[model samples]
Target: MAGSGETSEARALGEALAALRRDCGLSQAEAGARIGMTGQGWGLYEAGKRSSLFRPDVQRRLTGALGATPEALMLQAPGGAAVSTDRPKTSHPDNAPAHGLSARGRAFEGAASDVRRLRLETDELAPWASAGTVLEYALGRWPRRGQGCVIQLQDGLRKVRLYDRADEAEMVVLGAGALDRSERIARSDVQSVSAVISRLDDA
Candidate 1:
């Protein structure tokens, strides 16, 4: 469980995210689309009035959607789980994940240090990352959801699409030059979104 202090910090970030969403004149779903989230993932983020920004990829998506810097969305990510305090010394959320790892692994490797350091600071991530509960929608439909990722493999920026409709699932256009493969995506090309999955809702 997160400490009382961390819980308070998470609440602040939530408010910041909601405020940013209002400033954009968009709903949670719309915000998610901006970052390439779709279905349940995008909706949960926006609806998470008391929820915290749990993943680094989610934070990045929020920053891009809000047109804010990495620092802007940093605070939105709250402190919880073993990943926060149990790790090597680290700093910088954007530079942490190290790329080329699963969302959970990346969360531990890169964002973990950021989380610990966050504990020392206030219950925020530099006051920039929390601008809103930004999300990523379905950027493409090549290998199917959870099978591919839309990201800037080199720089770590996401290459995703915004919201769109289809038969299989929803899509969000995150980037113009979305990558693809032969019925499968090269994991190295996409930023595997981080999340601590629990049966909550569906898209």
Candidate 2:
């Protein structure tokens, strides 16, 4: 959650970026010209913090112009602090609790530490986005892109994934016998998914 002051403070950081440019005595056009977004790009970047998808090159230029560290500019961003750097590799510096799994085995045994980790806010799994969670997703096609789609959903009984956003009660059916049929359809021209929770509701 955003602290009441976080968004405002972030905008202030944008303001700082603008001031840094001016202190360097370059017009927005001139400053942006050196970068690539143009003066218009500079204005948008500083004033409208809402739009933050900038190219890595642009980020590098702005970082240099602002005389501020990238970390300083991106503090506590909800989408995440903008950076051009590659993701930090995972490491288990803390030895595992006396569990059977080794450090390597434990990497994915619990909560993921990166973006996915953010989405898992509940021990029992939440149906909606939580503090650190991204929605669970399924890959399939409706009508448009046959390649696949990403939908918010969850798995049940350790064998199924669901597409809760699909307007219909469609769940990824997994099992050994009848489920083999749907799994086959999913691999090809599957029109709709089956809903399994209905039967398990009383369970």
Candidate 3:
């Protein structure tokens, strides 16, 4: 028999999973169908009857079915709320577009001081970003799924890849070659992961 504390934790996790499913506009049955699970089977997780919810693999399967990440599930846990990054759009004369400049060009010109820039010298991240592209990234901002990010290694090497998902021990990223080719990198080897906010083509 399970102890009270363990049971309570399972219930909390269940509630969080339920919240994430709801946020994705999915019913239990619909959400489960994505991963080939039956409605009743999936309900067991939401009802906190299945201890498998405590497993990392199970959490990935459940959340992936709802098109969410495990980190997102934690945010949906008890007393936690979904995080938002929306900001009110503001305009300034200095930020206005200059003649012959495209919208993105103007954005690059007016990027915030805190935004760090990097120049790509390879086609590793081709199609998304190519050689000679200038990338503007925010140092501490987390990247949304499919967004570009700069992953800096502890050894001072940097990799530009599309952000996938990250857990406590490792981060999965879409690597250099194909968008579907994912690579898992240990968190210990990472110094920082910065979200790429803008990409400017070389002049």
Candidate 4:
């Protein structure tokens, strides 16, 4: 049940999304696969069937995949500015190439406050974070027990796990969902740990 303004915005957003996808030469299914969703699921966004497109987290994933911005999609404009309908010139982030296709695109400008985006690659943390899910992790935020986290180990291995507990000597993490698995690793083996602040829904 959206109001007239909301509905209008939704339609406009959908059209922009559809256009962006086409410009990138990606099919709905291929676009969906990048974010861990089915083609129908992705189409819903372009069809303006789901309100989640208005959500900041969801916008990050959708626009990131398109190599565009929220402004590019007309989702948000600065200082209460009116969104322009002109096609935005796509701009990649400064280090966009280094991260390959995994980096968060210049999209979600307002939502990128000290946040970095990473795509989940495995289902080890399934249900909570299955493969294809996109995670927005805070750069320096510490994770409390029972929170999702990205752990970078000294040996250069990175893992996504639910934070269990941590001490000066070691850290404990549990597999999310019904996996019923846990592991403890020495603190010395860890390089960094950051809290996963938000997950973009591709479901």
Candidate 1 lDDT over residue span 72-163, tens digit each? 43433343222222222344353455443222212123434322111111212112122132333222112223332333344455432222
| Rank list by TM-score | 3, 4, 1, 2
State the lDDT of candidate 3 residue by residue for 1-203, as single tens digits: 98887787778878888987787688888776554568888899998899877664466557655645455666677755332112212321334421110112112333356479999888878888888999998753456568898887877788899987765567788956777799988877876566789999977
Show where candidate 2 strays beyond 4 Å: 1-6, 53-58, 65-203
Ranking by lDDT: 3, 4, 1, 2
TM match of model 1 to true structure: 0.39
> All candidates' lDDT scores?
0.38, 0.35, 0.68, 0.66
Model 2 vs. true fold: TM: 0.30
**Per-model C-alpha RMSD:** 16.4, 18.7, 12.4, 14.0
Q: Residue-wise lDDT of candidate 4 within 22-120, one digit each (tens)? A: 877989987775545688988999987888777644565576556554555664322222533323324434433212112233334553665888998
Query: Candidate 4 clashing pairs?
Result: none
Error of 1 at 142 (Å): 19
- Give the distance in Å from residue 119's predicted Cα in candidate 3 to where it truly belongs: 0.6
Which ten residues in a row are the worst by lDDT in model 2? 98-107
Per-residue error (Å), model 1, residue 141: 21
What lDDT is reached at residue 126 by model 2?
A: 19
Give the runs in model 1 whose Cα sits over 4 Å from its true position. Answer: 38-54, 74-188, 191-203
